[model samples]
Target: MTNGTRTALATALLLAVTAIPTSAVAAPEAAHIEGRLPSGATYLMDVPADWNGTVLLFSHGYRPMGAPNPAQNAPDDTTKALLLDRGYALIGSSYASSGWAVTDAVPDQLATLSVFKDRFGTARRTIAWGQSYGGLVTTAIAERAARRIDGSLAMCGLVHGGVANWNNTLDPVFAVRTLLAPDTDVPLTGFEDQAEATAAAGTLTAAADAAQKTTTGRARLALAAALHNIPVWNDPSQTRPAATDWEAQQANQFPALRGLIQLPAFSWRQEAETRAGGNMSWNTGVDYARLLGQSSVRKEVTELYKKAGLSLGKDLATLNKAPRISADASAMAWMSRTSAFTGKLTKPQLDIHTTGDALVPVQTESALKRAVTAAGSAPMLRQAYTDNAGHCTFSPAEQLSALHTLEDRLTTGRWTGTDPDSLNSRAAKADPTTPARYVPYRPAPYPRPYDLAHPADGR
Candidate 1:
């Protein structure tokens, strides 16, 4: 069977499986609050009647523009109601824009909190919960509002600034090869002339520009193919290939031909590149004008290359060898600057990630763990990993377990004991035949006990 047919079959099977009804967990009843922020922007919130001192402020992953409605697939309502049922107030907002404009959600979130206080009285403790891009917002919020918020839960959040976190997961050489020559399996055959490569790069960029205008899932898939030269409509039977193989295939396929594929698997690559390249650059310009710290230069360099049709393999090598600490130092500095926020969180925090999450790989979690650990509050943080595909979807038990863990932390300010094996057991069950290893958490020891007590103090 062709790769496309396999993908279709697999997708059909998935839809079939989801359609099969298992017992639906009863969701809690909550008051849906809709109002305009003080800034005149409209927003939505799910506030439950059961009054607890804690407010659960959730930030969603990426979504199209507009407030979430019942028909939408947003987990915000469900998550809000779930927390409300557990005795915490739930609040969130419809940020101004979609795409990378999620940074705007931070102020909207704060406005929601202000509204929650007016309607239900001030929360004694506020916990910020964000998933994916929501996680990025959560990090930003935690940084600015550490004193206002007691604790925070960042699930599969992007911890590093300026760089697309996922770009670090793949081999740099493969990244360059995939973008420059999608149809040919050749090793870094040296950089093509900038003018010629940029023209071809423009074709891929145009495809990406077109993809962004589309809202349909199919268009998303097409955009992925056109920009990244990846086959979205591939055989489902083909298990996840190694990164090397994936890159080789992309390098071998021409962007034009790959763009013609019926499915939009290639859209993700375009999205990734576009994000790493254009959107992030725009964000830096905005933040810098506001005198906010600049994002990592490493991330900027990666995006600059993609935008200018430069080769990743050669550029990364050049940056790494440069005397100015532009490459490695930038990422490290960004993490260090953000480290101050990790100390401000007083509430119990739980970070849940899937070991086999293809979209946001396990290494992203590792980077976050390293950042938290370096900040000197490792014990305060609890991480749980599932062997699941996609993003945060988990089995009923897994979901309940995570909710319960969050509930325990919110109410008692203490995390349940870390059961490394039990935490990873679900992911293990999903793929029993494979010998996948769990990367255990290893934190650097703190020099003084006070580091744990006072995270705000400079190390």
Candidate 2:
């Protein structure tokens, strides 16, 4: 199918899948659920009347995990229903903000799992499955809930910190910095300084205010662009429709446009307005730029600069002359020190990635393998790589293989899988017409505990 056709079909399939009711297929017996960590946060888990001992607690990707909000595309209710039909008691936590607050979510997940087990009395064997950010959350839970969780099925998950997976890099601050640094040649210092100045002058706030005041479509476009680092037309004199003006231009374009904007190399250019441009759409291209020029966006740009050690009032000349610091303080803070993945893995784990996943690169699996090895937990690691677009864009065969791997680990307490190198090579040899199969699971020899290996915490 053509790319456009594929996208359209995918969108339709997504809508259809999410619209279907879980109750339609093997309705779950309602069970009382309660939250131990986040007071009063609770939900009803419908354990399938014919559920087997296998209980699958889903950790949704990048959204509110345990919340009672209606399921959307991806790991929604329909997906949960499918697992239910497979004889697994499906449990989900109404985790705060889909459990973005990791510290809070961890305790809540354990508590909810406990509630499910106590209420149902059948959750002897448990498997945690999560996609993307949900994968990270799942790993976190697995690391802590080693005694309770039998195995984990993580798709497009960063076994380590999400930031570390250069493939699955999600932080907008990093994405914007990387993109703008190359184009401007002004050293991030200049952008940071401009942001500080804009913040002090209230330039961004004023622009946001102006966009809010005006009913023009261009204004709304400008506001969003500014807020999200959409590159603006360097020539401010260019005229365009207000953002609000084209709000309904192409009804189905917004979500896809937003998804595109999230990509690492997504550039907002003025020339994109022309019809000859291949990938850029007029509304997305124009609004992206206008939003880039907003004051609020500038402030964020400045914040990243500051985080990177470029102080306010520092000229580009000074920043350019400064040495590239060895220790990225921000990275250290968000990743190494506080990150849950910094520790060793105690249980069997499987990580899945896609070679063509534009958002999160396949290299991330290697990076994670190296990081875990470096941390002295190689024995528990296994990875599977697929040659598909986006995260978890695996064929049905690939998904089945992953499911089988999870079942093996849970049932037999052993993971047999090939390493990443072989998987990558095999994927390269496969034709696009052929469905990718799981490169057999091969567990690495477990390394001695970090403390035992180095005696000084492997510093």
Candidate 3:
């Protein structure tokens, strides 16, 4: 999209009017506000007539560099309408740029809040929230912008931080390239441009697609997915596979495996490299066998290999023998600086995740939990899970219920109705038609967790 068109889309919420159905709480009349920040980011805001003295600052997730940039003030249209109906103000920015945008998103969101306060006065309370990459941005704000926001919500976020997230992400793509297409020449990092990245991704994806047809290929794919922490259940419409059904589980993981290699592995990696000035990911001294052993899916991988009449040991040896990739120190430092999570929260933060999110796997919560505990901020954080497949697929009832629960904590100075049963009950009250799937869950430790504290190649 052209720069002008992108700006227009970002400001469209304030420039346009929509007819809201009277059925949803009489469709509160709202005042639209739009502006451009000094950083050149476009922002949009909506405030209802009966203002609730609360504001939600939204930080959107990664958008590919070539895609259209539209400002998202809420996770979805239904959520936006419900927030407005409840007399809450909503605001967000397009961000300075997209694709792994936490660097720009945090500042842009905070700047939008500054603008809102200057225009309408300080809100009684503000909550920062976002999904995917935006979730990381929200966490950063919760850490650094405590004076500005009262609380925060992160949905299917990469809270483990960019350095950790991308490092683990590299593990799977490396496995795919080394095992599935050893003869093919597709660079994993430091791409010349999006065109080069896209081409490499296409080649890798095609290799994965072809590999899925053979038993040996399926076994290798399972190993790659395990390294990536990709969940076995990807299709929300399909029933989750039985734990011991290795065949069905591998089948479910194949699509996520292919998509992960294409997007974050190649396309997103290129964008991140350009922004960071060089390669920020490495596998220089990684032990493929030990990494697989640490994975929750290791048993599944072992079973799949046995069934395929292949030796897992041989493949691991091959992977170990392959040449390792190294990161530029400056680039690695840049990524960590912009995206690392300090886990020092001065305000309450609630993170929600689907148990089977393939993109930002639920294991990310484990890493974040470790950081928060180490930082002595565990009491300020609560993570809830849904027994569902796919990414950020929470029902409207669930979404609203989470916000209400967080708001209750902010108002009462104590957390209540946060357990699965209570959360489900609250969601039922919000919308009885949609079933609430909140369940007690504890994610296993991430297999290839990496952060500044545990730098790659021992830094």
**Candidate 2 similarity to native, TM-score:** 0.52
Residue lDDT tens for model 1, 1-459: 999999999999999989977667455466777777655546666556566667777777765333352211124444344445666666777666554444457787887778878877777877787777777777768766767676677775654432433222212223333333345443121113333333444454444444333332122222222222122213222344344343322222223233322111222223433333321111111111111011111233333335445464553343234222122333323333432234333345677665433334334544455556676656666776655444555443454355456666666766663465554453344334333333454322211111222343223
For lDDT, the strongest prediction is: 3
Query: Residues 1-459, candidate 2, lDDT per residue (tens digit)?
Result: 899999999999999999999878875564434343344434446566677787766665544223454322125544455555666666666454433345544565677678776767856678777777667778787766788787777787745453243212212222223232223322211122323322322332333233333333222332333333232211122232234323322121222223433322122111111111121111111222222333323443344344445443342232233333122334323333333365467776787866434343344455457656776888777777664444556654454456556676656767643454444334434323336644434222111111212334222
Q: What TM-score would every model get versus the actual structure? A: 0.54, 0.52, 0.91
Model 2: weakest 10-residue lDDT segment is 268-277
Off by over 4 Å in 1: 1-30, 64-81, 164-347, 395-397, 410-413, 420-459
Question: Sorted on TM-score, highest at the top, how do the candidates line up?
Answer: 3, 1, 2
Q: What is the alpha-carbon RMSD of candidate 1 to the true structure?
A: 19.0
Q: Distance (Å) between predicted and true CA of 15, model 2?
A: 55
lDDT, residue 329, model 2? 35
Model 2 regions more than 4 Å off: 1-37, 40-44, 64-78, 98-100, 162-337, 395-397, 417-459
lDDT of 3: 0.87
What lDDT, from 0 to 1, does candidate 1 have? 0.46
Model 3 lDDT tens row, 1-459 = 999998999788555544445475565466898778888888999999898999999988888987988777899988888788888999999998888777788888989999999988999999998888889889999988899999999999989988778788888888999999999888988899989999999998999999999999999999999997778786797668898999999998888888887788888889899989999988888888998887868899999999999999999999999999889999988987888876778899999999989999999999888788877888999999998999999888898889999999999998898899999999999878776999999988876565444433246
Alpha carbon lDDT of residue 373, candidate 1?
Answer: 68
Candidate 1 backbone clash number: 19
